[model samples]
Target: MNPSIKKLSDIAQKTSKTIIGLMSGTSLDGLDIALCEISGIGPSTKVELKNFASVPYDSAFKNRLKAITSVPNVSLQEVTLMHTYLGNYHGELILKCLRKWAVAPSEIDCIASHGQTIFHAPKQQHNQPQMPNATLQIGDGDHIAHKTSILTISDFRQKHTAAGGEGAPMAGFIDEMLFTHDTEDRIVLNIGGIANFTYLPAKSKDRPSITTDTGPGNTLIDAAVRQLFSKEFDQDGKIAKHGSVNADALAAFKSDPYFRKPLPKTTGPEFFNLHWVENKLSKAGITNVSNDDFVATLTRLTAETIAESIKSILDDKSHPPLYVSGGGFHNPVLMDWLRKLLPDITISSFENLGFNPDAKEAVVFAVLANEMLAGEGFKMESAQTENISFGKISFPN
Candidate 1:
C-alpha cells in the first residue's frame, strides 16, 4: 500500500484530526484560512477553530479573479493559468498562517480547500437546453497538495451538482452539526459576496431545516464602490451612510424574476452583476444617481431582501434569533436596515457564539473535510436535494 494512503487510513481511524480549511468567497476580498481541530461525525461532530486568519488579496490578484468570475466570457489562458496559480497561492498562504501560529506542516492531517468560485449556474437559473445544473471553482487540489506536502481535499461542489443540486449554499449540513440548539430556533445568515441562510428549527418543531442563497450581499455594493469611488468596498458603509436610498431604482432592481422565485433557489454575480443593476436603473428611467446613493440603495436592497425572505416564513408572533456572519455583517448600514425592517427579531454577530463572522466559511469547509475523513454525510434539506459527501482528496506523496 502507498504510504500516503496508509497515512490517511490511519488518520481516519483516529478519534480526532487536525485539518486546515481554506475559503475564497465570491467577494474576492481574500483567503480565509482556518486551522481546525475536528472530531467525531454527523450531529455529534465537533470542530474547533484552533487558529484562523483573513489574508486580503492585493489589487493584482483581485483584478485577475474579476477577469473570469461570473463574467459572460473570459481569456481561456488566464482562466487556465489561475487554476494552478491560485492553488499554489492559497497553499503558500496556509503555510504562512501555520508558521505564524508556530504549527508544523507534518502535524496537520489534511487541508480542505474551497477554491474560488468562477461561476455557478443551476438549470433553473440558466435554462439552457440539454444542460444540467452546473458550476465551476478553480484552484487545483493537486497543486495545493504539491505545495503543502499534505493531503488536500477540494472542489467540493461538483459532487453536490452531480447529485442534482445547484452546487451552492453548501452550509446546511455543517450549520446543523455545529450550531443547532434544542430550544432556540436560529437562522444562521452568511452574507458573503452572495448572501445565504441556514434555518435551524427548534428541537420540537416538526419542520425540517434548510439553507438557501438570498442574493447579492456585497457583490453589488463592492462593484459600485470600485466603479464610482475607485475603492474596493464602501468602507464601513461610510459612502452609503452619507446618501439616501433611491426607492425608484430599488424597485426597478427588485423586479428581477429571481426574487419572485420560491425558496431553495440559487444565484451569483453571474446573474446579479453591475450590468444587471444598470439595466434596471435604465428601465426605471433613474438617471444621474450619485455614487453614494447607488451604494446606499444597494445596501438597503440586500437588507430588505434578506428581511423579506425571513419574514415570509417566520412566525409573526415569534422572533427567531438571527446570527449573522460574513462581510455584510460588518456593514453598519446594511445591519441597521435589517434591524428596522425586522424589528421583532434579535440580530447578533456569530462572534457572540465563539466564531468570527469572516472565518465562518473557512470553518465550514473544515467541518466538511472532517466529514470526508469520517467517510460519512448527514442528510440536510438543501440545494443538493440529496444526502452527499463532498471534497476530492489529493495525497501529498
Candidate 2:
C-alpha cells in the first residue's frame, strides 16, 4: 500500500468531510456541481447531496469545445491550452456555486473532478498492438487546486486504464457502493451522451458485477436535432413525438456491428456520430427522410440498444430492479419506449434511492475523492476491478 493511500484513509475515517464532485459529460451541455457530505465506505457508505447545480456552458464555449471534439486532427497546442483553461473555468463555476449556496470555501474539504473527456480509445476500438487502451480527460488538478485554494482530485479515469480496464463507465464503482442490495438483483442505468449500466446480482457472492456501455444514449438524437432541426436537444422528446420513426432507417441503425458486440465493451460519439448515421442512411438509400422522423428513429435507436443490452446480461431471471439516472431520463419519448420494452421489471429514478437522478454521477466523483483522501481502495471480483486507489490528488498552495 502506498503511504499516501494510508494517510488518505486515516483522514477520510477521522474527519467530517465536505466534497464537491464535478462532472461534465460528453453532451457539453453544462457542468454538474454536486456538494455532498460523505461518511463511511462500501455498503455502509452514506452520502448527502447538500447543494447541486448545473451551470450551462455559453454558446461560444460550447462551439469552441465542439470544434475541438468533432474534428479528427486537432492541434496538440489547442488541446493543451483547453486543458488548463477548462480547469480554471471549472474552478470559477465552483466558486459561483459556493457563493449561491452561501458556503465558505474553507468549509469544503476537497473537489473530485471527472474532467472533460476529449477522446476515449479503448484497445478494442483501436486494435493497435503497441498503443494499449487510451483515454484523455482535461482540466488539470493543479490549476483547479491553485485557483480554488482547496485540495483537488482530478483525472480519475487514468488509474482505471492503467489497471487494464477501459477508463470508462467509472460509474460502476460508485453504483455498486451505493445501490447494491443483498436480496434482489438491481440494474443502475445511466443515459448520458452514451448509455451504460451496472448489474448488481441478487447474491453477494456473484463476484465481478457487470458494467458496460449500452450503445447510444442521447448523443445521436442530439446530433440529429442540431443538424436537422437547429435545436440543441430534442427538448423533452417533443420533436420526436411529432415525428414518426422510419422502420427502414431504424433497422439500419440497429444493424451496426457495435450492438452485436459482447459485454464489457464501451463506445462514444466517435463511433455513433452524425457521420455514422448519415453513412448508414446513405447505404440504405433513405437519404430523403423527414427531420422529425430522423429524430424519432434516433430516439428508438437508444431505447432498442438499451433493451437488448439488458436482456443480454440478465436473461430470464429478474432480481435487481432497474434504477436510472443521467440527463436522458428527462427525455419522455425515450423513457416511454424503455417502459414499454422493459414492462416486466420495476423502473424508477435514482431519486427513489435518495439521490437526485441528474446529480448522481457528480456525487459519485465526490465519494471517490473522499475515498482517495481517506486512502481507501476498492476490491472487486470482476475482471474490470483494478482494486487500486484511483485519482491523483493535488494540494492547494
Top of the candidates by TM-score? 1
Candidate 2's residue-wise lDDT over 372-394, tens digit each?
76645876443465467789888
Could you tell me the TM-score of candidate 1? 0.97
Provide TM-scores for the models.
0.97, 0.94
Candidate 1 structure quality by residue, lDDT tens digits, 5-24: 88989988889899898999
Predictions in order: lDDT: 0.89, 0.86
RMSD of 1: 1.6
Cα displacement (angstroms), candidate 1, residue 342, comes to 0.8
Model 1, backbone clash pairs (residues 3+ apart or across chains), number: 0
